[model samples]
Target: MAALGLSGCSSSEDGGVLTVAGSTTVMPIAEMAAEQFEEETGTKVLVSGLGSSAGIEAVQNGTADIATSSRGLTEAEAATDLVTTVVALDGIAVIVNDDNPVSGLTMDQLRSIYAGETTNWSEVGGDDLQILVVNRDEASGTREAFKKIVMDGTPFDRSAAVLPGTGQVRDVVSRTAGAIGYISIGFVASDFTSSTVKSLAIDGVAATEENVENGTYPVSRDLYFFTKGDPSGKVEDYIELVLSDEMSQTIRDAGYLPLSDASYQARAKAAGAEEGGDAS
Candidate 1:
């Protein structure tokens, strides 16, 4: 993953080929946007999912034109020359195997479960099977967001099986009968009945796009595209395309929450109010 953006320069020399690398959570939208941008314009965009931190590092090291991050930047990171733009909002869904009967969990229950305090499904109103905890690796932005929002800074159980990406988490939870994991809601199948893993509501709030848009979901986070400096030329045009109405359907089709004009303005205002605050 570290080698992903090592060869690319922040500025494209041929007036094409934008290099983007970052969060797997943001990779789908970036790829979709890239394809659309490429077709509409002549610029070619290359994208990679190399974890959030690595993405930022790529930008800082001049290896990438843009860095995608699921979580916001920290104060130290924000203080750097890099600039961040909020592209969308996403909900982190807590998922379990479809065989698990449990439909919801309170915040406390979720914290306890991840902390290794509750080891049995029965303790959470499920079948009497031993719980299998699946976690994201340390480099993942999803893992960082989950730890901050769900665990409240508590460390995950050491015994939890840590995987590298959201896809792996979903795959593991789908196959392991008692497994529990978390992923961006965008990766979840819209046809829940056919999906092998089921997303659980947290504290009665469902993990749906509508819920995220309405601010009713508890585990939502902003997605970002970071630039080493203010963008120009094709890079600037690409960012405009991503934020424009042209990409609204693209965002939804990718299973992410698309911001309306009002929502976008509101988010921008809120972000402005918190400038220099710790993000990731």
Candidate 2:
């Protein structure tokens, strides 16, 4: 989908406006913050989920004021002077349909499955069913993170059906037996323990928030907000609200790791130390 445009009055009297575009994984957090921000101040925050690459491009082209991403910038994108902020922490959950008897897979087995070398569930200890691998589209930050953390240097199977959003991947896997896909841990629950799909453990480790916090989860990542240099005026104010203590509970309620969490604090420091540019 195309990025969302700024809507409503642009005048300061209307409380100003800001546009956010990026990862679907980060969209829920941004949307929640936007509502609270609008209620607290009169500013109109327009948010969209067009994938991480699109969001970064929107900021570079002056179409968006802020960009949210689920993965770190590439060497080329990092050279563009984009200032990064670690907004939250998350884990990528590998999911299958509830009917599937298989519970977990080793890291090597997972890599092999996605790489198309393990085409049958029986190869990994399940029923004698053909494995249907679902994947995210190229623009997805989740896909990039998966490639780095799970696939390592291996390419995805050409036979996999690549969809565009987290929801699509989740839905497809939920209905098709033997289908498997990965998505943010926050998106795992329809209502915490009541999801239609089942999250599988990796290397005998469950995909839980606690596992992510202790650094045991095999596929954890930091969620980000990128700004073109330092933000100022209303844009700055809105970001401050999102990062503030008042928003911590809102973030937690939405199933994300808020900045107040000790685990996120540690991850944030490391990410901050590695960044060296601002978006121009």
Candidate 3:
């Protein structure tokens, strides 16, 4: 991996292309950043939302310069020389059709519903309508995070319709009367006042950015950008720009928690000190 990156360095110096592929959850931010980076540096960045697993695989095969993921790597993936960088923090919001009377769900109830134990809305304080479950495909980092954080040891109901991306799951849920799905909170905007699907509270706590930052949100996870060994040249530069103070507002505007919040306090403080020194 390092050899591939070193080999590509010469090309990067000549305004070569940088390929980034990964989680659809991270694609929007990457696309926005790519636009700005291109404008400033004149390097062409090719970004694709091909699911987290695919992105990791692309990096492993030397096809992609970086991979964006919403979940941590598996044991097998961690064993490789790949490096992980936490780009931001996000919540996995449980969403239901706007017409669904059901609002919030307890963690246990949500587990049961996904496990096929609770099949109807009435079972969890809603109408008598049959519950329709929308799920993301195996390749999705969002699905993996939901499985680990929300499902825990419980297996997902095989009968649920599985889509390949976050947007697809949300779209299906929004159009289906009894459908419920989980997606990155970033995609939902500030709230669901105008959306066809509304977000639900988990264990009585709302899936808001504040709750996520305070550690009250149960389904929150760190967003990531992965690379083969360590990044170099344009790859390193791009990652640095994404993590820099210049991108903090962009991260916030995209609905994900910036590095200034939650677990990133120390780093944020350090960054501030460095900026202050430079100014002085």
Candidate 4:
């Protein structure tokens, strides 16, 4: 299957196949944007989920046109003098077993739960049961977001269940009793029916699109696309395509909240610079 995909990518003529890499958290949106881009402009885009760090490496090496990231890279990335663009915003949501009675929680309570201090749900207003924690892999930006928000500057409990990816986190949480975890809104589907996992409110605010867009979601973050310095080629076009109206529409379709006005305007500026560079 990988071989076939490579072949397909190699066949593009509009501007040659544009290679992109990055976080699995942003892969679905990038993929959807690429599909619509090809449909509209006859250009092809090749996207890969190589982990965010690996994607940054790809851009630094000129191996990819763009690097989609859920979290910004470290200082080392900035030291390279690469150009970064904000393409979207996302709200990382805390998901719990639907049957669990506890709904909203303050960030402080979350920190206690993940720290293994608040073991009984009854302590948080739910039925008596041992607290079960599910976490994303360390490399994932989703995990980082959780750390910054829910963990309250503390580390996850060593006894917690750690999954390799967002999908795995979701799957495990959905089926496991007393499960609680976090995931990007995009991975959620209508039939994710384990019926076991549901979204929980953070700090008295609900985890809905409206809340995320309105800045009520405490865990909201900007999504980025990192590129090599002074983008001035087909690569630039590919990045610009990500902010197009159709691309924005796809984001809405993915069940994730759209970017706020400031985010949208910033992306527009970045796109203009990039696309214009390709022109000159």
TM-score for predicted model 1 compared with the true structure: 0.91
Of 1 and 3, the candidate ranking higher by TM-score: 1
Model 3 Cα lDDT, one tens digit per residue, 41-119? 8888878888999889888887778888887889999899899877887899999988988879999999998988999
lDDT of 4 by residue, 61-96 (tens): 656767778877687777786787777777787887
The deviation in Å at residue 20 for candidate 3 is 0.4
Query: What is candidate 3's local distance difference test score?
Result: 0.83
Off by over 4 Å in 4: 1-15, 189-196, 259-280
What clash count goes with each model?
Answer: 4, 4, 0, 0
> What TM-score goes with each of the models?
0.91, 0.91, 0.88, 0.84
Candidate 3 vs. true structure, TM-score = 0.88
lDDT of each: 0.84, 0.85, 0.83, 0.73
Which prediction has the highest lDDT against the true structure? Answer: 2
Q: Which candidate order results from sorting by lDDT in descending order?
A: 2, 1, 3, 4
Better of 2 and 4 by TM-score: 2
Score residue 185 of candidate 2 by CA lDDT: 92
What's the C-alpha lDDT at position 170 in model 2?
A: 85
What lDDT is reached at residue 245 by model 3? 83
- Candidate 1 regions off by >4 Å? 1-15, 190-195, 267-280
lDDT score of residue 69 within candidate 2: 96
